[model samples]
Target: MVETDKPKQHRSRVLEGMAHAVSQKGYGDTTIADIVREASVSRRTFYEHFSSKAECLVALYEAASHNSLKVLRDAIDPAHEWQTQVERALAAYLGSMQANPVLVRTLFIEILHLGPEGLAARRRVNSVVADFILSMVNGSKGPKSHVLSSGMATAIVGGINELVLEYIEQDKVKYLDELVQPASDLVHAITRT
Candidate 1:
C-alpha cells in the first residue's frame, strides 16, 4: 500500500510545488529546480512526475480545474429553480476562485505563458466548463431551440471566464462573488427566452 501511495503523494507534492513556484516567479521564470526546491523533493522526483515545466503546469491546471468542478457540481441542486441553480453554481465557483487567489492567478494568468501546450490545456478546461454549463442548461426548462445550445453554453463560459480574468487583472479577485448576479443574469436571459 505504501508503494502504491508513494506515486500519488509525489504527484500531489509536485503539483503543490508547481502552484507555489508559478505563483512566486510566474510561469515564464519558473524552472524544474525551483519546483523541486519548492516541493522539497529531489530533481529526480520532479522529473518522475513531469517531463517539463509546461507539463507540470498542465497537470497543476488540470488538478485545480477538477477540484473547482467538484465544488460546482456539489453546489448545483436540481430541486431548485434553474435560475437559482445557476446562481448557486456561480457563487460557488467564484467563491472557490476567491479562496485560492494564488492558484487562480497561476492557473489563469501564468499558465498562458506556456505557449501552445498552455493554450491546449486552457481549451480543454474551457470545453469541460462548457460541458457543465450545457448540462445545467439542458436540465432546466427553456424554449426548445430559442437559446441554450451547446455553442451558447461555450460562449457563456467564455464570458464568465473573461469576467474572472478582469477581476484577476485588477487584483480584485475577492470581488469575484460580485459577478454572480451578472453572470446568472446573462445565463438566465438566454434560458428564459
Candidate 2:
C-alpha cells in the first residue's frame, strides 16, 4: 500500500510542480529541470511520471480543470431553482478562477501553445465540463430543463471558453466574475429554445 501511494504522490507532486513552473516562466519557457525543482523531486522522478514537459503541463491542466469543476459542483444549492443553481455554480467557478490568476494563465493560455496535444487535452476537458453542464441542466426538475442536447452543451462550453479567453489574453483573469451573468444568460437563452 505504501509503495502504491508513493508513485501516486510523486505524480501529483510533479503535476503541482508543472503548474508552479509554468505559472512562473510560461509553458514555452519552462523546463523539466524547473518542474522537478519546483516539485522538490529529482529529474528521475519527473521522468518516472511524465515523458516531457508538455505532457506534464497537459496533466496539470486536466487536474486543474477537474478541481475547478468540483468547485462548481460544490456550489450547487439543490433546493433552489435550476437557473439559480446555474448562476450559483457559475459564480463559484469564476470566483475560483479570479482568485488564481497565475493558475488561469498557465492552464488556459499556456496549454494553447502545445499544438495538437494541447488541443486534444483541452477538448477532453471541455467535454467533461459539457457533460457536467448537461447533467445540471437535464437533471433539474422542471419544464424548460434538460432540453439541452450534448451538442448544444458542448457549444455552450466553447462559447464560455471564448469569453474567458478574451479576458485571459488581456491579463484580466481576476475579472472572471464579470462573465457570470453573460454565461448564465447564454445557458438560459439556449435552454429556453
Candidate 3:
C-alpha cells in the first residue's frame, strides 16, 4: 500500500474497532486493548489515530453522523415540492441510521457517556444538520414569507435526535423508519408557520 494511504486505513480501522467494541461491550466497558484487538492494529497504531477511548468514540460518532447526514443531503431534490423533499430526506436519514443498528446504539446512546465532549460533538453535527435543514426549507418552493429560522431548525434536529435516542435506548433501532413520517410532519408544521 502507498505510505499516505496506510495512515488513513489504520485510522479508519481503529474507528471501526472502537465502534465494534463499543457496540459489543458498551463504551464504559470497552478498553483500548479491545479496540486494537478488534481493529487488528497495534496499540501504537491506535494511539497514532486517537489519544483515548473517548476521543475514538467521539470520532466514530462524528463519522457515523456525517454519513447519515450525507444520506439526508443526497435525498433532497430542490426541484420537487418542498413537503415531498422533507419527507424523502427524513425517510432517507432514518433509513441510514437503521442500516447500522450497532452505530445506532453506540453513536446515539454510548457517545453521551463522554459527557461534555460528547455533547459538543453532537452539537457540532446537529448544527450542520440544522444548516442543511435551513437550506432545504429556505430554498424550498414555499411561501415567500415563510422562513425556517436557525433556532427552529436546531430544535427540529434535536427533536429528531430525541426520537432516535428513544429508539436506540429501547433497542428498536431497526424500527427507526417509523419515525420518518412524524419527523417530516414536524418540519412541515414548523416551516409552514
List runs of model 3 lying over 4 Å from the truth: 141-145
Where in model 1 is the C-alpha error above 4 Å?
141-147
Cα lDDT tens digits, model 2, 117-154, are 99999999999999988887888766663378999999
Tens-place lDDT per residue, model 3, 5-54, is 99999999999998889889999999999999999999999998888899
TM-score of each: 0.92, 0.90, 0.94
Q: Could you tell me the TM-score of candidate 3?
A: 0.94
137: Cα error in model 1, Å: 1.2
Q: How many steric overlaps are in each model, in order?
A: 0, 1, 0
Clashing pairs in 1: none
> How far out, in Å, is residue 126 in model 1?
0.8
**lDDT of candidate 2 at residue 134, scale 0 to 100:** 87
lDDT of 2: 0.86
Q: Report every candidate's CA lDDT.
A: 0.84, 0.86, 0.86
Per-residue lDDT tens digits for candidate 1, residues 1-193, read: 6799998998899999989988889888888988989898999998888888888889999899989989998998777655656788889988999999879997688878888888899989889988887777676654444546788888888888888899899999988899999888877776663
